[model samples]
Target: MPHSERPSKRLAVVTGANAGLGFETARGLVYQNYRVVIAARSEHKGRAAVEALLKDCPEADVRFEALDLSRLASVRDFAAALRERETALDVLVNNAGIMALPQRELTEEGFERQLGVNYLGHFLLTSELLPLLTAAGAPRVVQLSSLAHRGGRIDFDDLQGEKGYDPWRAYRQSKLAMLLFSQALQQHSDAESWGLDSLAAHPGLARTALFEHGVRSRALVGALFRLTLPIMTQSAAEGARPILHAATASDFRPGDYFGPGGFAETRGAPERARMSATACDAALAERLWQVSCELTGAMWREETTT
Candidate 1:
């Protein structure tokens, strides 16, 4: 049988898999016969999501694991748990993030909440799981980015947003970080022969819990989002297809971006996503990677399967 047609025992870890795009991604992977571990912040929701997936694909091999991306301790703990439970991990989907909040908030590690959870947390987690990923031979890492990254400007000095804070800027910076970091990681993987495929993607406008949270935080923006979401957004399942493609596609190209190809790249089939010129800055990505290492105390260079 062809490799794609053969049954796969590959194990995958998808963060924020309790709902929305993450849940859909997990469901799709499980349907492909991949053993999926749904990493969610809420165990109840995680189990619920697994049950839902089972309902859709009763034969799917899926389970839930607890993870809180806003906390570095949580990231470490979650990774440690995975190490105890499994020897190798084939795919990791960094698909959980927050959008524009009404006010500035900090994560458990004192970094800006959005940046901490969306980029730094995932960064630490990925580094922590490098050993497992490498042990799995051919592995893939998919970072969830966003269209907001086009307008994002990383303020190196105020990375924590101590001086001033803008919700959109913070969210965009985190998303842009995901984009840059994925590309940089792919380059590093090639240099080290890590046998890892790193990719990034956006979901355009998807009808997911993300906007529900965004609306709750800021009523005015929420109203506008509510007004426009029905007309512009696609289903959560449709939005997750980009991530599913990045993870399951046989081509295995690193840094390949994917998203919807319809109007404004919002509501169509999965394809190459658009990004800003800044998203291609290797130097900036390196700097951000360095700073992330400093902040999270996760030294990716030290990671090895042996």
Candidate 2:
């Protein structure tokens, strides 16, 4: 249990907080005095992460909760348990994700693996937790997008990648969906007066386990990526800066996207990142939102949007 549960302290839930960028983000939040819930799939990893967090900050208010984003039931169960314990949720960083799989895969629900874990799971999780988010006077939700989104296109006809599949293509599409969802959610918040702030951010080539997990060792592409990674990429702690900024900064507007500000957006400090024309397409965003509701059976305001 966290040492302090002061009412004045804001509570934050960071998905994938067991390691990498998510862990760094959680640490940053704790430093700022926010009580954090480290959401992850593995109990061992989650508990170890909590202990590591305490080791760094003995007074830190942080704990682990089981949340496997690969399964919809787990997402719901995680949210339900959280709602039972906390009346309001101040921040939600949809940071959990898996990278490119060498072979195409599907989630238990039969959705494309990348799309299922990266976008759909977070979409449903956000929907289920909307009530708690709204209960707070002002709440923020941050979606982790990627530079890969620039190369992504929403292939509605092959969203599940059943017709054809390319590892990087599927991964790109999922990230693009995340960016689109972030915008659409902000628009809905504005139109419906939900009083929620929705934002998106990218890490700009952060050095993390994602590269190791996503790429094949013998693959030439993976080799090249690794060779250039140290030169082009920043550390995971640096990567989490933009996400933290979006989650806690007072000057950001709803729907703003942030990333590293150095050359090519590879490193430095937080700055407004560029958005692809497709990412800025309002019509495309709305269409994707409707499709996501249908895919996940996630209802907004107790009802799915048409």
Candidate 3:
């Protein structure tokens, strides 16, 4: 429990905060004197997470907000509701995402589930909350990409994974999109004098429930994940460090990407991580930004101060 729930304690929003690295991220922020909102897809899980967090940080100011990123409508609803209650948003951790699903699925909005939830959803959320972020004076937005983004390419032609779906490719592309999005938004912020800092991070190989989805049908993989998880992957607490660092670091840089400093970025302390060249294509990022605005009807151009 915090000794003081100071009025004007910094506020943060952590998506997927109900579990895994997101849970650890939220916990660490609470320790750092943040009043956090745990955004989850399930109200039940969201409330439960707040209850559990209260056990450790009894004075931590935290609450649950239902956020189903898979659907644009849900994103809109969440944003509108958020605006009603809060005028300032200090930190936004876009931490919610799914890894490899054996079969491809689409959101009700009919976009590939991975790209929809991982990249597009956060895109809209960030844009919608841009005003509140600006009101906070200097806000940080952290987009959680992946080491997988190193090998990812955005197939703009098959954005929805309609031609043929490989779960890893879809997941990778979404992560790549995240990096590109972060970089592009930062560029816009600098050009427009938005005073918003946008950054990216990866957890490397953190042992989390996210793996359960990938290993469900493959007995061999499941066994490997179970047996080697502890040995190969870092704990969720370790994974959250990069995120918490990006959110609160004093020397933070816009468009900076952070991850593990160890071998292949698998596990260790935080550092400036690698990213794919494809993630740097300005033309591609502009196209993706436009596509995201069209898909979500977020209309971020209207938010420009200039």
Candidate 4:
């Protein structure tokens, strides 16, 4: 279907809608007439964000819902709530994610913090919500990734960073896993005629709380980030455009990746960006899919296989 022809009355669920690219993506979707559900980890922040969005766009159909992607039970509960409330979901933006934290942490579910929240959590969430997404004529799943994925390696033996952990390395691996998952999802959907579009996008380098979160936890690193922000950062709104385009643009194809189109994809307008070679590896994509299924215990394989 053409982009213009896509239904405007659709419902969109955006994770991490309390701030950064997720907030901006919600705003853009609201402007485009989508009834947006802002899924956040904190009720206070989510409510505050909804109020702020309404202040700018009084008619914006935006609501807040609590979701902490680091917890599998929370993901299941969130998915169940959405299923009970809505008959169909036209767009699901797996936008909530964490970046480099100085120390390795584990989620409530016992997975590496970054991997748990950024990749595995979304993996399970999407799988559980597949019924809602599939109910719509053409649903879209947009997985938010990062350029750092270029240097990532899927350490199967050390997926949880239990053997050893470097914050940035773990973050990169998680983001790469997200990209590969999106790609695998697209391929699976196509092979099974699942009637959904799976796409990936990244916010090059945007000045968001992610950087602040990194710095606040470590002074020297925080200082370095503040020092470099002016030279490397782009506005959150600009960074979110690729995600919006991938979610709503008519030209999108399954497994397509989008991002800023300037200065090594660091800062510019949104465009169809190229993914890293590692992210495009079919073998790794399949391996990640199997591992994700084992972790989430989601019925994705059964649904697609049948």
lDDT measured at residue 38 in model 2 versus the true structure, 0 to 100: 99
Q: Model 1, range 143-218, lDDT digits (tens) per residue?
A: 9999889999889989888899988889989999999999889988888888899998888788887856765676
Question: After TM-score superposition, what is the CA distance of residue 268 in candidate 4 from its true location, in Å?
Answer: 0.6
Question: Candidate 3, which segments miss by more than 4 Å at Cα?
Answer: 1-6, 215-231, 301-306
Q: Report the lDDT tens digits of candidate 4 across residue range 9-104.
A: 889999999999999999999999999999999999999999999999999889998899988999989988877677778999999988887788
Judged by lDDT against the true structure, how good is candidate 4? 0.89
lDDT (Cα, tens digit) per residue for candidate 3, span 135-205: 77688999999888988998978999999999889889999999999999998888888789999999988
Candidate rank order under lDDT: 2, 4, 3, 1
- The alpha-carbon root-mean-square deviation between model 2 and the true structure, to one decimal in Å, is 3.2
Number of colliding residue pairs in each model: 0, 0, 1, 0
Q: Which residue runs of candidate 4 sit more than 4 Å off their true CA positions?
A: 1-8, 215-228, 301-306
lDDT by residue (1-306, candidate 2, tens digit) is 212343778999999999999999999999999999999999999999999999999999999999988899999899878876887889999999988887889898999999999999999999998877887879999999999999999999999999998888998999999999999999999998889999999998888899566766338877887788877889999999999999999989899999999989988799999999999999999999999999898887622222
How much is 217 displaced in model 3, in angstroms? 5.9
Instruction: State the local distance difference test value for candidate 1.
Output: 0.87
Sequence-dependent TM-score of model 2:
0.95
Error of 3 at 189 (Å): 0.7
